[model samples]
Target: MISYSKIRTIAAEKKLMDIVIEKDYVLDWILWGISENDYLKYNLVFKGGTALHKMYFSDWRFSEDLDFTCIKPINVDKLREALILICKDVNNKSGMKIELKSIEASGDTKEDWSYEIKVEYLGPRQQSGGNLPTIILHITYYEPILYEPVKRTILKSYEDIPGDFFILTYPLEEIFAEKLRTVLYQRCYPKDVYDLWRLTKEVGD
Candidate 1:
């Protein structure tokens, strides 16, 4: 049982309100489309470096680009089209230009899973410190190759504001695993190492 006030304090201490808000809006748009289409059979998850697992247990400072996973297999083209249409509609009403980046689809033979749909936002780019591009959106599908796709809902560590339900993301454990792999494969950043260390300590218990 994670306390909301603890999460709120960490967010405030790290000045992560803006990033959290942006992530919320982007996810809300995706969820709205899925819900409207009666695609609730699919489960959505928010994962990656941006979702700080360490913060689940104790306060820590970290940052991440948006990454998500959809457990239902989907028509990649249709999903992209739907996302574009939703972005356009939202922009029209809110005057926020949310552009979709190119979509990427791939499969995981080892895990017996396939994924489709990669949504990216091209508008209102946010820069962190001096270099990192603040990615606004990402969506991916995960399905087991041998079995029917399973519906798994993992709540994210963030406040849910009205009209922005997408902000509620996947579990910190998933994010921690992805981040650990990222650090192992790529030239690791200090923050990534730090985040991994802190997250491991928290989840280890």
Candidate 2:
């Protein structure tokens, strides 16, 4: 398995360690709150951007968001409220103006299945500090093929080394599928296209 220290060193070399460390602290805070409040069982699936893909042997461009998956259905409103309060509390403690933005449920999506939340800093572009220029948090739950709720399951994989790592990521095949769908249905980002190629090669190997 790739050593966590190695990952941290790589991030530090890339000037991303500060952001990484800050995000980890914030994530732990959220986890603690969720556990204390009996929110739901969840595991931190993803952390540092490149570290995520690195765990899967895929080449991914840098990203500034923290992605998580809930192992059970969460009360959307309650979760949002709690996150907002936590953000405020953290801001008060740190003197950093962090903003929590809730994306309304829409577009033929079923409730109690999956949703997204974003937490960002409010300031001038250059004024934003951390490894994350903009902090985007993604929270998704399990949904079956028929849009039915299902028990959230952890996705596990072995790192390139000889150890196991729980990867909070879609399967490489599914990722490719989504990439294709995005190219067909939305304006494609060049980096995304590059990522698809990189992932494809890695999976093939």
Candidate 3:
């Protein structure tokens, strides 16, 4: 685990210390450790806001959850067990407490099988409240690939947070396409609009 001081020093050097919070730095490390393990063990591909944050260097929005898409069919029960083990391993390594609350699997075909995992995090970084913060990971297995996935190397300057690593994710154009689709066909989120605008400025359609 990277020390908080190290994260701060790096952030200060990058001129992002004022924007990225400490808790988020910790969460980003935890997310990286989990993602690294998942890619090694299950070959899961990262996606959504988290992917965008990595793909777009100037995009500084912090993601609250992790999202991924499975490349092929796998046993749901086994996948759940692997995920629980991953949470346990990350907690042990990072000194963060994480527990898997539940894993709900739905959808008939492999192309649409969705695995929604509810995870509880009991860490000092979070505010003391009635309930602890839950890390939600939405996984869809065998989703039709809209574009080819590529390995993205997240440089430290991009986020000024810990846990920079290489992750396989859909291309920027695909992410842009999905963002537009969400605005048009799905629930509208202000962040989506902002992301769409940012993508337009960064990469043209």
Candidate 4:
């Protein structure tokens, strides 16, 4: 496991909250692991706020949840096994220990299935109730992709784990469209408005 001091130092260098960097590190490896996992590689289409930051805007605010739209129906047992394996792989590669605390599955009567996973990681700030950092994973199977997901390159400045990673995700325009869709659904989400503004600046007009 990487020393908490190293995590703290990188956070200081990046001028991000230590908790943010810590979560980002955990997220980076999880993404990498997802790309490596054969089932998840095809099943999960990266989406939502985290995908926006990692795949599109570098200046976007740090996102706390890893969200994906499942293109194919997957049994919960298989998903649970896949994520457990991914965490083990991430631990080996990044020296960051991530434990899968819980995986819960639910769906509306129409079979719009979804899963929520809670994972805990070692952290210095101890923000979580148990003095550990946690990251939430939300996987929804019903969101139709408005555009064909593309394989995009992902990067992080951390020298510890170097290399370009890739993920299958919605294009910038689709993310913007979805953000706009959400804005209409809710009256007071400032983040969605902020994201729309930034996305407009990136994609133009």
Candidate 5:
């Protein structure tokens, strides 16, 4: 966990909301927790908008939730256990209070699972009377890996206390493909358009 003052200073420097800065720090700690969890380390491959920011490009938009594709189908009970333990480990190491509040299954089955893990934080922002913010983990099980998952280091912005940790994530090519899918088949989100354009600029048309 980053110091309250340090977090505030960052928010000021970036001209962003204080809570956003706090959430970013909490995100790092939570990912650090996942890094230490052996099951989550290999099973969950990080992806989506947050992955774009954390693994691929800086100057990308800040992301609110964590999206991961579980390589194998896992039951709710086992998933809950791993996540609860992760929150505990993070609290112990970072002195930041957090919990796996609930795991909600929107759709999907035991064979192909999708869960939303809400991690509520009693972080520095709580001092400012903001509601306890949650970091949502969108975990989808029984997903095929389109490309070879690569190990990537977290791109941290807050003050550094802990060292390096790596997680498996989609390569830039896979990310572009997925983002393009969203833009074409889904709602054509503004972020998708922006991301696709950025990717084109980075790797060429």
Candidate 6:
């Protein structure tokens, strides 16, 4: 278990409030741990803005959710159960109030089924200074991963979060393509524009 004092120290060093640092730490830990869970093992490829922050780049923007693409079919009910258990384990291990709020599935056809899990972390309310923080994990299946040579990276322990796990990520070019598509098709997010600019500056057009 990570001590509150330790978390506080890290937060202070990063110039981030304790609640922000603590909630992020627990959510990151849970994501890493979920990748290694035994009951629910599959080829879950991480992606989206969080993937950029966690793997593809050095940008420090905070991401409140995890996005993944499953390389194979998944049992939604079983996955939900596993997540509930994982949340309990995270609560016990990290001394954070982690709860599995809900799991929602969507998609038009069998070729693309997406499951989004909403997790709530209730910290010391007084210390947090507001409502609980929520983390979302979105997993989509059957839509094949486009890019080959997926970058293999390791997620190392940070602050109070402990775990070293390998993460499979789409290449920079593919991530760039995804951001472009999002900008065109979906509600424009400022972060996507920012990411595109960064990609242009670093990786070039």
Q: Which candidate is the best by TM-score?
A: 5
What lDDT score belongs to each candidate, Candidate 1 first?
0.49, 0.47, 0.67, 0.81, 0.82, 0.72
| Candidate closest to the true structure, highest lDDT | 5
Summed backbone clashes in each candidate are 4, 1, 0, 0, 0, 0
On residues 46-145, what C-alpha lDDT tens digit does candidate 6 reach at each position? 7777777777553446677888877767788878788888887777766767888888989888787899888887654324556567888888885455
Question: TM-score for all predictions?
Answer: 0.52, 0.49, 0.76, 0.89, 0.92, 0.81
- lDDT, candidate 5, 1-205, per-residue tens: 6677887898898898888988878888888889998878998899888888887776788888999988877668888898899999988888889988899886655666688889998886556465677899999875567899999988766555366789899888778887888788877878779888888787565
| Shift of residue 115 alpha carbon in model 5, Å | 0.9
Candidate 4 local lDDT, 1-205, one digit each (tens): 4567877998788798777887887787788888899988977888877888888766678788998888888888998899899989888887667889999888874358788999888643445455577799998887778899999877564566546777899888788888888898755388788888888888786
Question: Model 1 segments beyond 4 Å from truth?
Answer: 1-41, 53-64, 106-168, 184-187
lDDT of 3 by residue, 1-205 (tens): 4445665675676666422544454446455665556533346667777677755563557666777777777677777777677777777766667778888889987667888888777553443668866777788875566888888766454233344466677788877887888799987898888878888987775
- Candidate 1 lDDT: 0.49
Q: Where does candidate 2 stray beyond 4 Å?
A: 1-12, 15-54, 57-59, 66-74, 81-103, 108-116, 121-133, 139-167
Worst 10 residues of 4 by lDDT: 122-131
lDDT rank order:
5, 4, 6, 3, 1, 2
How accurate locally is residue 103 in candidate 6, as Cα lDDT from 0 to 100?
89
Residue 64 lDDT in candidate 5: 87
- Superposed by TM-score, candidate 2 places the C-alpha of residue 52 at a distance from the truth, in angstroms, of 4.5
Which tens-of-lDDT digit does each residue in 30-99 have in candidate 2? 3333333334333333322333344344334544455555555566677777777766665554444567
lDDT of 3: 0.67
Q: Model 1 residue 159 lDDT? A: 36
* Model 4 backbone overlap count: 0
